[model samples]
Target: MAQAGTFVFLDYYGRLAIERGFVKPEAEDEDENGEALPSTSGAAKPKVPTISHSAALIEDLTAHKTAALRVELANNPDVALVAVVHAMLLSVAYPYNSEQSALQLTLTPERLEPSMKNAESCKGLSAFNDLADNYGHHLPGNPAELFDWLLEQPQDIVLSLLAFGAAHSVNAVEKKFTDRKKGIEQANQLGRALKVNMPDWFETTGDSYFKHVNRMTIELSLAEARGSEAELSVRAAAKKSEAVTIADRLVAGTGWIPSPLRIAPSEAEQELGAESIAEDEQFPQAAE
Candidate 1:
């Protein structure tokens, strides 16, 4: 089953993709004679490049329908997405590169070009050619920016690409990033804005914790969760499964859920003040 997320940014991103793909595109540029504009000095014009396939992807992704997203990709090929996928698969194809340690996160252009080219050939997507032509050596910026861009994508496939690309291809070439906390905060803020039903909104169980992360990491989490001394001792002595049981009650919800749920503001709240609407308009700055 497809997982729900905090931010629902597909609608805006989908529209952006369609607009870039067709509406008033640069390809429509014309001269005064109503003929296609000539490049300066009679030079051939470079192909215009922009993001694409967002709207189609958005339809499936917004609903968290991963299966539907694959069907969309099958019916309508997108080059950018293909490049993103094939490139990511290579990262895990080998043993972890722990020996050649560096903080860099993006794949080298030389290694990536052939893979993208192969996908472009297979998919028959000229957009891949555009992507290679323009951004083969480069990708979008930091994790926060990448996460922000991911939310803007319309499909689960596209979103997953950005996520994968950041960790695999894009990050390989990029330099070591320092502000991990900011990226996390950005994610939390986006989740809150999008109104996602966060998994953690449920009582955290040993199963959820042990499955995803190393058990020792719970020590830090316990500290942040403000567990009791007894709970801390439990975390130290008990298995991760047992530790999480105590940890659950110590933590507050992450704010993504509508906790302390209640009705929205009443008409009296909407009125806000004793002054009438017209009176407020007359004294424009008074409310401020």
Candidate 2:
């Protein structure tokens, strides 16, 4: 049971009502249309973390500044982004400030309730409560949405105010699952990998694809896999990336996922290539 039923305070408020689980916003509860419907009976309620100092913490993440982040948490532990990140930072805060600055550490989560009542008054609580526990990566809405956007944005976006584990979503990881730009299509190739050992929980409905990957990537992938060869309805236009996606899938299923692409050539590789070229250019001892 939660230590407290849910806090009713100035900065924080809500009733977790864990018995029913976490209910997302009406928008989150909506279907493809703008229409909203009541959830059916006996569905698992999602979990969302509760915390305080939400405004400052979210600002720190949105601003994407590490120093500012450290300061925010240092000044107020309750400002932590999510449980995982909070857990991590708590283990590393300080004695290193040579200047012995005015940092007063507090238990980040201590300031918030595991549950709250009437969350509306809270500034950022609802926006980020889902991220409070280690489960922040599992956003209530389209799970692939934020991560899909992240792929197009600079890598630094990962370090933005999400704090701690906010950036560690399955979707975030899927984007970096393979080499070069192939990572962008990692979701399309996921079914191939999953075929090796399907998850008991996985249900291959249309929504499954949307939950894990962007639309275009999945469509392009299906086109290659089942288009002309299998006569399945191809969903999108042709993409030259078909080969790269296939290769990535093959590599992914083999218990091997390549590391991020190296942008700069290593010194040894540079020298070896040059040496090989030089040797090829040389005549072999006048054929003696």
Q: Which candidate ranks first by TM-score, i.e. highest?
A: 1
Off by over 4 Å in 2: 1-244, 250-260, 263-269, 281-288
TM-score, one value per model: 0.22, 0.17
Candidate 1 Cα deviation (angstroms), residue 65: 38
lDDT of 1 by residue, 159-208 (tens): 55545444333211112555455544354445455564544233343443
User: Can you list the residue pairs that collide in candidate 1?
Assistant: 57-154, 57-155, 58-154, 105-171, 105-172, 106-171, 106-172, 106-173
Candidate 1: 10-residue stretch with minimal lDDT:
1-10
lDDT for 92 (candidate 1) = 30
lDDT to native, each model: 0.44, 0.39
Q: Tell me the lDDT of candidate 2.
A: 0.39
- The C-alpha RMSD in Å for every predicted model, in order, reads 27.6, 27.4
lDDT of 2 by residue, 1-288 (tens): 112133223333543233323343332355667576575334564444456568888897766776766777667533332322333333223213212222243322222223323335443344445445534343323322433433354434334433433222323122324453554445335534445233232223232232245545555544443455321233322542443344334333233211221122445767999998899888455664
